[model samples]
Target: MAGMKKLLIALMMAVAAPTHAEVFAKGADIGWLPQMEATGYKFYDSDGKEEDCFRILKDHGINTIRLRTWVHPSNDRASGHNSKDETVAMALRAQRWGMRVMIDFHYSDSWADPQQQRKPAAWEGHDFPQLLDDVYNYTHEVMQALKQAGVTPEWVQVGNETRTGMIYPEGHTDNWPQLAQLINRGYDAIKAVSPSSKVVLHLDRGNDNAWFRTWFDNAQKYGAKYDVIGMSYYPFWLDGRPDYSESISDLGANLNDMAARYDKEVMVVEVGGVDTEPQNTYDMLLAVQRKVADVPGGKGLGVIYWEPQGARSWSHYELSAWGADGRPTKAMEAFRVKLGDK
Candidate 1:
């Protein structure tokens, strides 16, 4: 254990103080991938039964687990989404196994992303200030619930895929002030209950530097405070995965620039491309990680491969199902390489 800690510390130091040439090297050691705990479609599973999956992941190197929370889904069920109880159960299970927890707040009943930012059922008629208070109350209650369950989160995301602002219209103040207030409300709520938890402001466009500038600039304009700037990097969906070299340079520059610009840590909170695709996408993902590990800001924390085990066997709550055999998927190999475990 002492040796492992020493190695971890040494790798971090190397990443923090790499030379200019090292920053651009094709085989750089940006940092090791922090082993994470991930649960995708299983999060929405009824009865909240996923002990086997959690155990399997724990046996691996994953030390943290992330679950998403929506408001009120059109479906009147509490599987792995929208319902606070379900999320709490999942967190508790992970906690029981001594795994860290990260809760992703989507701020909508369904999927909240750059495309749409829907309002919650109760806040449909509320005004801007009222909506702000709603956000504060919702965040407080949820975090409080987790605490009562003895599952304090290691990380909390204010909004999910929020390429656009969250709690729409009023809180979505692209003008800065309103947006800052809304963002801070959530941040403050998390801090109030779980002061140790790291709060994140998430966006969808990971590769686009302009989007990062605009969103973070607006958040700052609105006095938005957060510990990390999170992004979703799905090359299959977004700019079509570039070659490993191109991905490394572009993504590394983006991470370095964003960290410097915001003076805050950054993370690829959600990232994955197709593994069973035209084949190129899967290859692209591996190359992307290699490039990131070699880039300057590639050490911007770690990357979370969104739903690699969620093979499409499950629907409605269909997350990605990258798992090929009963074992892990090819994407797992990419993460292994990221950690130098390969």
Candidate 2:
């Protein structure tokens, strides 16, 4: 009968639907947290009561944590920790809190960004082939370590803010073929150890479509293997390059274009605002989230604030979202406002 046919079709449709919807990640890169705690930093909730940092983050609607891992970090206060073992421990702690994890591999002993991508001291004087092996081995070793710790990261960035390239002259963008090989090695190693982890290739300047186009076109030409395209958007660091209000639309357009053009998901892997201007920072955070959430087909994976808990008093970092009073600033309140909420 027609009624029986309708019931059958409805049941079939229900069965075919996805078991769970993909969550839009609201995340923070608290890579400095352990060091901050070790150095006597305390975190408090909005109620002015002392509380665990993770609990405070959870209450602020953060569902994901991004951790950066350096090859062999120094013991310097501002630039130490985040070694492989430390990263594994942090990932375990985050897992215990039921938070999703993203591992950012700097592939260097220290920071690797547009300004510099120095080879780890251990990797110096190595040939290109040996460098490739190093990348693969190091990536595999970390992924295996995380696996052994029973913490599987949902995403892994092979390199941090690798706009020009990574690992110095060898992997620099000038040599696209070699750079592609290095990228693929890291990507392969990550997949071999954790098959489900999505590999991200991160770059700075999320608003510059032309730069993204040029960079990714070369990536495609060289066949760089990656699952996601990550970007860092910091209008504050633009140095009067352009204000956030002027560039926000470009960011949204670039996110949509990257997803469509590359056939890959995109994420705002890092964003922050001036800690002193909490209201402006709050508004900027909300605007960045909106641009990301508007990516077509839900390809906008997330927006993660970098080092939000690294209070300026302790870290001397102006972009942090924590106040000198040891409580989250109003900038963090933006995360509590869901995308579609009034």
Tens digits of lDDT, candidate 2, 1-342 = 999999999999988875322778899999999999999889999999999999999999998999999998998889989999999999999999989999999999998999999999999999999999999999999999999999999999999999999999999999999999999999999999999999999999999899999999999999999999999999977768466888899999999999999999999999998899999989989999999998989899889999999999999999999999999999999999989875
Candidate 1 has an lDDT of 0.64
Instruction: Please list the residue runs of candidate 1 whose C-alpha ends up more than 4 Å from where it truly belongs after superposition.
Output: 1-51, 74-80, 239-248, 277-299, 316-327, 338-342
Task: Show the colliding residue pairs in model 1.
Answer: 37-64, 43-80, 44-80, 176-222, 180-222, 310-320, 310-321, 311-321
Per-residue lDDT tens digits for candidate 1, residues 286-322, read 5555545543544455556565545544322122423
TM-score of every model? 0.76, 0.94
* The candidate that achieves the highest TM-score relative to the unseen native structure: 2
- Number of colliding residue pairs in model 1: 8
Q: Output the TM-score of candidate 2.
A: 0.94
Name the Cα RMSD for model 2.
3.5
Which residue pairs overlap in candidate 2's backbone?
none
